[model samples]
Target: MTLDSETFRALVTEASLSPSVHNTQPTRWRLGPDGRVQVLEDESRRLPVGDPEGRDLNVSHGSAVEGFCLAAGRRGLVVDVGHDGVHVAELTVRLGGVSDPLAAFLTQRRTYRGKFEGGAVAHAAMARFEQSEDLIVAQDPDHVAELARLYDEAGLRWFRNVPYRAELVSWMRLSRRHPSWSLDGLNAEAMEMSGIEATGAGLVLRPGVFETLDRIGLAGALVAEAAVVRSASAVALFHRPANEAPFDTGRRFHRVWLSFTQAGLSAAPMAVLADDTKARESLQADFGIGGERRLITAFRLGVAPARDLAAKPRLGLDALIV
Candidate 1:
């Protein structure tokens, strides 16, 4: 049966909340006459510099598809997703679906970019993650410190790339004055940055200014996240089978993150560790990751301070539906 406009709007709205690379929200939804929902990638929103291969972009779309499925399940609707060339996926919706346990965490999940409170994750939480075949947790303080250093190094390496830096700044809504501040991209408040800090970031990230700082050996220390990474109760490594498609990997990615939410913990992805070639290789070797597995991403797990942070900026439903 065809989904009415109201039901379609609700499903797409929930799906749009899924995380995307640089908050690009690149997926577009189209409802067909036959009632199948088509997921399409908005090529204009792609991160050409940061994600040249579109790997992360595909993953983002995958997560959105999963989000749509979960939203459907919550309403007692089932979605059968299938590969549809020229589109990300074609979803056939039907009734009689069971609600997903993870759906409850969808609205609660946020990327806690601020410093986590001082404490360890609950013992039960740690145990649950340890039992997962796709997760590896590093809790030792010393090991965490080492990983933090590597993460900073990898991040700094990317920061030195002019185009990459520019692309990042383009997606950063550093001030409330930005026209799209509350509509899309990474707004300052959502990043846990104060106005002063956001202003400072805008200046420091300028290519010439950053280069000058780097020449003086100040850039590394200025942008380093060692302290934040060290503050995490544990670092989690998320992996998938080597030959698996990123779309499939992304489906699991959202589930893994929601699992963190279910356990009453907060997390922020340390994507640099998985994105940088050298860093990825180092982590695989150091952590005994089998050759058959690919490290998709990493997250810093901990407790965030209690506060009502601002909502994540997103494009409206009009822009999402084509």
Candidate 2:
């Protein structure tokens, strides 16, 4: 369990792969004087406008911790993990343990942003999730279209809300030329934008552009995003009532993500749906969800692309460790 500085650095790098809101990479770490690795939620990285409830931040932290645990297990270590303070988690890795079979997926998983080819999700891919009461999959084109409509409406709401769009825009790194492009947050390349279209898209992200689109009622929902939603083989929603077992919810949610990745299907978050309260409520009603259950996250799944995706830059472990 003894970790030199370099080993500790490697561990944290692998752990930080868990997705965050806008790729904020909101978690930080510190190699304690006592040898345990302390995982803390970076207060500065909190997205108050985008995630007012802080549930999304906490869920993302849980997912990051899970990734760290999987990596530890893969290295033959038994990990003791727990929360020490608000948004603070502690990890102690001891030698001797069987590796997690899902460990490989920790690196393989990332939100797929490309448009999906046609066809419904295979029946076999879903059979594995039958027992998960909280997961709902929508494969019918009509159902997906309804979800897309909801997604676009949600985007409109975001555009109109100054605080929301401003907060999102700040995190967007327009191109590789931007200094922060590889360090953190959303980089344009990950969206597959290229050439003149890439530069044009960046310009529209400027202030007033979104506002003008909102005022004109242009179909300003991201074209590629809409295409992805419409072409998705299936859309998945994970639901649970508020104030429930939040950590377990995240763990199960991350597991679902990895499971689908292993099965060769890619999952992308329909984050806009959860950010707008009206769209969130309407989605619940449209799907006839019970009164007690509320959707926590929405995603679309499709076949993985033939090539590997470029790695999104993260604030590496050294920088992550406070």
Candidate 3:
């Protein structure tokens, strides 16, 4: 059965809402004959310096594809997804009779990076989160500690280099003033910084604090130690057996993220941890992802509490659409 054009359009729009590295919505959409939806990577939207290897882009596109699949599935549709690289994925939807209540989450889900409520996540919910073969969720305090070390190591290594630092600054949208970097780059507000503070401080690390912060920012479990702290209730690290042509990482990310969204969780990625080879290897060593199957994305999951965090805006659909 064929889906109406309006229904297909809404699904694509919902899919595009998926988060990316610094909110870089890198996926492109093309609707084909007989209800085929093509989700391609727009290389132009890639973070060349920050994510030179394109790992973040893959995960971002994966999130989009995942959202698309969920949206389609909710409407009694079966989706077959294919990917060529971190940037491109193709999803073909054929109308099916299956019903998915979680389909409603496609529009409701948001990348919430704030203080999560106290108490352990329900085991049943966590079990559902672990169901994805492409992803692994870390629940133990030991696991969080090990993962924090990897994240700190990666941040220190990457942020120290002048080039990567400059690349990061380039993406920092400094104000309610500048606009070119809209919807994509890091919004100062999301960094736990207020508008006035962010504008004055810019992206430069303060001279002395850089050393301490380089080790671990406020995001890790360390800074929030005393508070009723929670990282992603279930931290999912997406990986592939061996990097396939282009879509290996993207395909893996999409399938896993979609599964999480299907299970009623607010997911947010911590790219600072995922970009480093050493960090990935350390995580692999701890998690035992051997051989060529490398880590492609790291996502944290939990119920988001009401807090005032930065909400990065997106360009209108017209701007993203070809």
Candidate 4:
């Protein structure tokens, strides 16, 4: 490590908070030579069923890189970032460039999967979230309701698939007794799982619950749909041409997330829209997107309730740095 231990740990702490599929926390950090921070992908942390194509992983790495830059900017440092490949990103820190106004919120951002107190989101509040021209956000009530239904419809296919259910069951660390309980995977609190559901899950969750909850996916599937509809105040969707780079979109997404954080509003990423092909097409068509653009990401924007905490787990600083 070229940087001092304290500086390195601070960078890793902020960077690791970047959200990943199933809270997998797939990106790791190390202080490289010449004052650069190296971001490495932990391929072992990839979710086979949820992100087999690694699109989620690629976007996740992008978010982490943005996070590190934001963290540095908070301390009056400007960082130049580069994505070398799908797995490797390098950041060279300098002392120039204007700091982000919301840079202080790099650590306070959380993904709220629960219901939001619904109302009209101020247009001014949302306008700042459009970091780039690529973002397509819908804040009206009718449009948001329709998007919710589409999310529900798209998830049905994944619900019946044995492998997908098995993979979800594997990540359901519903009990503290589970070995990965403190390190990674979704916990009972994060999922906002009801008592009965959590009990049933804790009783039978294993590497693959193909025999247990695999049959119970119908209920789980409905809950997933309801959560999106119930919680969102607005929906932000993004698209890019097939030949263009999608990584910058992730960077823009994180800035919007941090802006919401500074405003006391919370949001949740809805990757299911991009994960299912039918869902993605429906989204593009419904939104009147053109120019051979593909839906790369979508999220529900709303004000989260008070006292809720982030439930996704992460490895220790030492564990994250190699």
Candidate closest to the true structure, highest lDDT: 1
Q: How big is the positional error of residue 177 in model 3, measured in Å on the Cα after superposition?
A: 3.1
Candidate order by TM-score, highest to lowest? 1, 2, 4, 3
Better of 1 and 3 by lDDT: 1
TM-score of predicted structure 1: 0.98
Total colliding residue pairs, candidate 3: 5
Which stretches in model 1 have alpha-carbon errors above 4 Å?
120-123
Model 3 lDDT, residue 249, Cα: 57
lDDT to native, each model: 0.90, 0.76, 0.64, 0.73
Tell me each candidate's TM-score.
0.98, 0.91, 0.75, 0.85
lDDT of 2 by residue, 212-244 (tens): 765676536543366668878888877877657
Clashing residue pairs found in predicted model 4: none
CA RMSD per model (angstroms): 1.1, 2.3, 4.7, 3.4
lDDT of 4 by residue, 1-322 (tens): 2345687678778877877677777888877666677789787887777777777777777777888788777766777777676547777777764678777787788877778776555445676656656678787778888888877777656665667867877877777788987788788777667767788755543435534454665445433565556457778886766665545655766776787788767777777888788888777777877747777778787777778465448878877888
State which candidate, 2 or 4, has the greater TM-score.
Answer: 2
Better of 2 and 3 by lDDT: 2
User: Which clashing pairs does model 2 show?
Assistant: 29-321
